[model samples]
Target: MSLHPFSQRPRYSQWFTAKPQTVVVQPTTWCNLDCTYCYLPFRRLKHEMSAEVSDALAESVAAFADGAHPIDIVWHGGEPLALGPRKFTALLTPFEELRRVGRVHHYVQTNATLITEAWCELLTRHEFRVGVSIDGPAALNSQRVDLRGRPAFDRIVRGIDRLRVHDIPFSVIAVVGTDGIDHPEELLDFMAGLGCRSVGFNMEEAEGINTDRQQPTPEQAETFWRRTLEWSRCHAGELEVRELEYLGEYLRMIRAGQRVDWDRRRLDPIPTVSWNGDVVLLSPELADTTDVGYGNFLAGSVLDRPLTDILGGAHRLRYVQEFLAGLEGCRAGCEFFDFCRGAQAANRYFENGSLATTETNYCRVTRQALVTALSTVAAKEKEETV
Candidate 1:
């Protein structure tokens, strides 16, 4: 029987009729630091969410958690800590209640500068998995400075030290810039010495508010990642590298005879809910656009629209379908699609004009570097076994 395009049945669903497994909630559009690479342009904004709105959002998410699937709530930009301790705790009450019944997991992605002793205590008390943003050591962190052109390394280090002193387990996220590309071994050593249990490395994405004049070239990126992997193999201690997480997950899928979720061009359409209850599709970078499809916040006020209505809107549905179709191209053609998440929508929007486009420059660099390194490692292992 000949396969029909529409009837072929995408390995993943074509549309989302249910709530997302993970939802990113922004408590305030305010941020303390002016990181050059921030996607939110948060430093320019002063919109703080009211406690009432935060409560309503929690209730809306709670409604979604009414289902059986595991749910994760991520406190995302612009610096969720800007919500302050009292408001942050207020926002947590609804989700925390759900956790009592063992129904929810909470995560926070933050720039460690705002991390205080109190914040560390609350995070550890609630068992929240924290991911701190720090781009390697002081020298490499020069680019990741405040608006006043002051290096934030000392403050960030102090914040991290507070976490350590308070016995709060946390992970580090380092942005790999051109400088970092030149010293992969040094960067890895710096991160390892921080005593963070895990680390995630992100290429300085040239998207949103991040208009960094200089970015690493594709060749530089490839070399940096290649060397980083070699360093990782040699230092295979308690350190968990987030960049390798997707690859590890993909390999796990292969071992289990299963397909990866993000790799299949599937739209896991993680919703980023702003403090005032506006929902943006995928990452916060999409929320930074001035264009129609760019800052397309389809669903507003979860109190007004049913979660079903928001997920089923024509714009959202079309975007999801188009995104999935784009993935089909990857699955059919790209050899490295299984390992990478086909590049992020934010990178595509910034580099190309649209999110539905084919492989991105980021993808090209990552796939070429990662696959080559993995192949070399596998071959060496085979030879050693022989």
Candidate 2:
């Protein structure tokens, strides 16, 4: 895990907190629906995790959680519920003993395609937080179809209906496409109707297998955020839009003229683990991607190594080294460096073809434009107050 002297300094070390507050585990890679913009390269591989491996990972993570800081295990997959009742139960059974004395919370990000009554009961009993992935209404979710190319929107709606009936509180994460960009207010209204307390927006990214992505201009992004802000004010305390939340926090820190600190949570690999115990550090999106130098973006295997050792193994991956160097370049060059430290690794790698670069079309539209838009709105409000 040793690195050259020059690569020793990481910007993350400057802002110290818990390195990985969350670990995303892929219990299986067998997803039912094939969303057009999915980044999972092995979404149809049907690889299920061995209980032995799961037990070993839990042991490793439980030891990490023993340090007294609360950590979360985010169960993700091609889709977690795809593991079915017996298998999913077995997957989580490893944590039963660990949960008694430690602060290890369970969460699952699902497509909600297979959320049944049984699933709700299991989640509730275990107190697993749920995040459903769905884009707006049926028309907006046309790209999220089944293997047979038929729209699965109706099934998704049915699942949401069941979640509501069961009194399960959940958040929604939607991929914003050209259609979403064109109709921001309409998209917001649709998700609010579904009873989601908070909504996360991931603009169509150029990552993994999905290479054919069209990015909106910065002006278009700013306009969309402005409109969405106006719509959100109408429902103020009810709906929480994640993008606006991040931007607003950034603006507050800047306006107060305080020394800014980076959010370690969003900074890097939040530690994504595969079914077989392969640990991909830093970028969750790096789980399914490959680099010539780092192979499958793996730093270490929890089944074979300690979590402490795996984190040390980060410097061993040239991909991470390059990412660290790229982050240095970003700090030196970009005006937005304080707000975003080189952006997400997968997006930077996929869009710019290198980690040591900055400012892709992705950042230009989302982070940069949102900042401009929010600042403008704030300035206008201040003038009106005068």
Candidate 3:
């Protein structure tokens, strides 16, 4: 048996495993809305995963389970809710046993336009962690529209209202494009107004089908993050900001003289099982976005082998090897390696068109910028205390 090469790294030796901490399952590929920055290439195809596939996943996912930390089974989609409540519930049936045993926790990333009372009931009953995708207020959210190019902001907000009425807690994920970067406070206020438990930001990047959109300049990106962190600190305890929270954790790790610990093995081989059981490892955005150079990013299939086995051999794939090399590149050349790691595989592939390169606008803006801002803020706060 070959030892996973990642385990050889000191930071990964303790927790390296073939099983992924998160499994992204695509229930269906039919999205109800068209967002300007949407990355999915097959969103128009209304394909749904067969029950057999979910059964296979439920059976195989047990091997990935840790003691108290349930493996995250994220039901991502073109719009998972596009499957609607009935069809979606049938899809959930296979995982009920695992969910009951506390071995798996389900999360859904939805556009939230289809969020109805039935959807809220299903969400509440399943106890699934809900993540709603809405960029911001109506003016800021013009990018998200229906198939007819009708703005979806009002419908999205309506769905959120339903979730709130049902007491279904959710977190919001906003895509911060160049236009939205300058309006952090406005975005923050709008999202916080929705009563979401937390918020996360995704910078508009040249990824998948949305490659033509203009990205924020490095200076603008830095200013956005600095102000974001500043606002997050002021609103501390009111809402959790994902990037800010991650920054705090990273800073804490540094303060304690601890190595990064690979941050869940650098999220290696995060299996994204498509409707037909085809697995795309690492970045979920790579699903259905084929590059012949990268073997279409298809690592393996749950139909052919257990997810564990595929992940076990992930390091041997040619593209994965290049990605690992990219990590080394970051470690050696970039000072932010400990903070940003190698960056996301999709970012590397989409921005530079290779998994073997390092340093993307994404890592610079999201990771490096956030780290610098947080460090500066921490130092200033420390001085004030002294």
lDDT of 3 by residue, 1-386 (tens): 23466654443323235457889999999898988788889888889989889888877797778567789999999899999899889889988888888988989999999998899999999998999999999889999999999999999899999998998889999999976999999999888888999999988888888888898877787778788878887887877889888877877776886654535443546789999999987789889987787789898889889887887767656667677678778889998877776759889998898888999999988888877776777787899999
Would you estimate the TM-scores of all the predictions? 0.87, 0.92, 0.92
RMSD of each: 4.0, 2.5, 3.1
**TM-score result, candidate 2:** 0.92
Question: Candidate 3, overall lDDT?
Answer: 0.84
Candidates, ranked, lDDT = 3, 2, 1
Q: What clash pairs does model 3 have?
A: none
Q: For model 1, how does the per-residue alpha-carbon lDDT over 1-386 read when each residue is reduced to its tens digit?
A: 12343543342345332457777877777777777667776555867766666677666666767546757888887878877887888788867777666567789988888888789878976778888889888889887677687888898898889888988788888888777879988888988999998887777767876765477777787677778888888989857787776677777887887764443344456777776677767556666456754336354556576444565452434444455556667667888766664546667667766656767767766665667767767777899999
Instruction: Give candidate 2's total backbone clashes.
Output: 3
Off by over 4 Å in 3: 1-17, 260-266, 375-386
lDDT of each: 0.71, 0.80, 0.84
lDDT, residue 29, candidate 1: 79
TM-score of 3: 0.92
